[model samples]
Target: MSTPNHKAYWKTNLRYLAILLSIWFIVSYLFGIVFVEELNTIRVGGFKLGFWFAQQGSIYVFVILIFVYIRLMNKLDKKHNLDK
Candidate 1:
């Protein structure tokens, strides 16, 4: 493999991070606060969707996003020949 390009690797990594963070912010903040009332109308089990998202959903999504980021970064690293 050729030498890994730090600038390009970090740039793509940051881009992925920004996108994931944006989604997390939207779900945890927007849906939890701004659209909570609307979302409250929908129920998941015994909990209001909004409340669930604010309390638990965001956490779950964050964990999932962490795994997704790991997988994505792994692929990216390999693509850039940085896995070594």
Candidate 2:
């Protein structure tokens, strides 16, 4: 790709990364800790929502995010004609 296109591609890539990471941070840190007590009032499968997030839910989200990132990057690569 040309210089401008390359720059745009990387910019989009970084933007996607930043947004996903921010979500992970919010789910893992904010929900798991800062709002734990409030979330504890809710239940999923007999587990406290907050406790689940702290112990397991965040991990699930992170793994899902990894797949999402991979998918997004693949699309981006195709868009930029960088995919093999």
Candidate 3:
């Protein structure tokens, strides 16, 4: 790829990373820690929402985000004609 396209691809990749990491931060830190007490007022699967987020929800979200990132990268690669 040319220099400009390469730069664009990397910029888009970094943007994706930034967005995904931001989501993770919100889920793992905000919901799991900062807003725990408020979230604890709700329940899910016989557990407090806050406890779930801290213990399991964040992990689940992380795994899901992995798949999401993979899918996004696949599309990006295709767009850039970098896919095999």
Candidate 4:
């Protein structure tokens, strides 16, 4: 319905990427590793929260994040006519 703009699409993609990257770093690196003990009390699935995060949760989140990032980038590429 509307003409696509590459510059706008690229800018939006960069913004979203920065935000998601920040969250991923904080959650998996900071909360999961740096503050693990302080977070242990918040448990789920029989695993101490922080411990789980550091051991397995971070891995899972990273995996999901990888897929999400791929999808997001694909959409961005399509929006900007950069997809091949």
Over 1-84, each residue of candidate 4 has an lDDT whose tens digit, in order, gives 445475688678889789778878987999888999989988898788999888887788778878888999898888777888
RMSD of model 2 against the true structure:
1.4
The C-alpha stretches of model 4 lying farther than 4 A from their native spots are 1-6
TM-score of candidate 3 relative to the true fold: 0.95
Models ranked on TM-score = 2, 3, 1, 4
Query: What TM-score number comes out for model 2?
Result: 0.96
What candidate 2 gets wrong by more than 4 Å, as runs, is: none
Measured by TM-score, the strongest candidate is 2
> Once all C-alphas are superposed, what RMSD does model 1 give against the true structure?
2.8
What are the TM-scores, per candidate, against the unseen true structure? Answer: 0.90, 0.96, 0.95, 0.75
Better of 3 and 4 by lDDT: 3
Pick by lDDT: 1 or 3, better one? 3
Stretches > 4 Å off in candidate 1: 1-4
Q: Give the poorly placed runs of model 3, Cα more than 4 Å off.
A: none
Ten-residue region with minimum lDDT total, candidate 2: 1-10
Cα lDDT of model 3 by residue, 1-84, tens digit: 479889999999999999999999999999999999999999988899999999999999999999999999999999999999
Q: Tell me, what's the RMSD of every candidate? A: 2.8, 1.4, 1.3, 4.2
Candidate 2 at 83: error in angstroms? 0.6
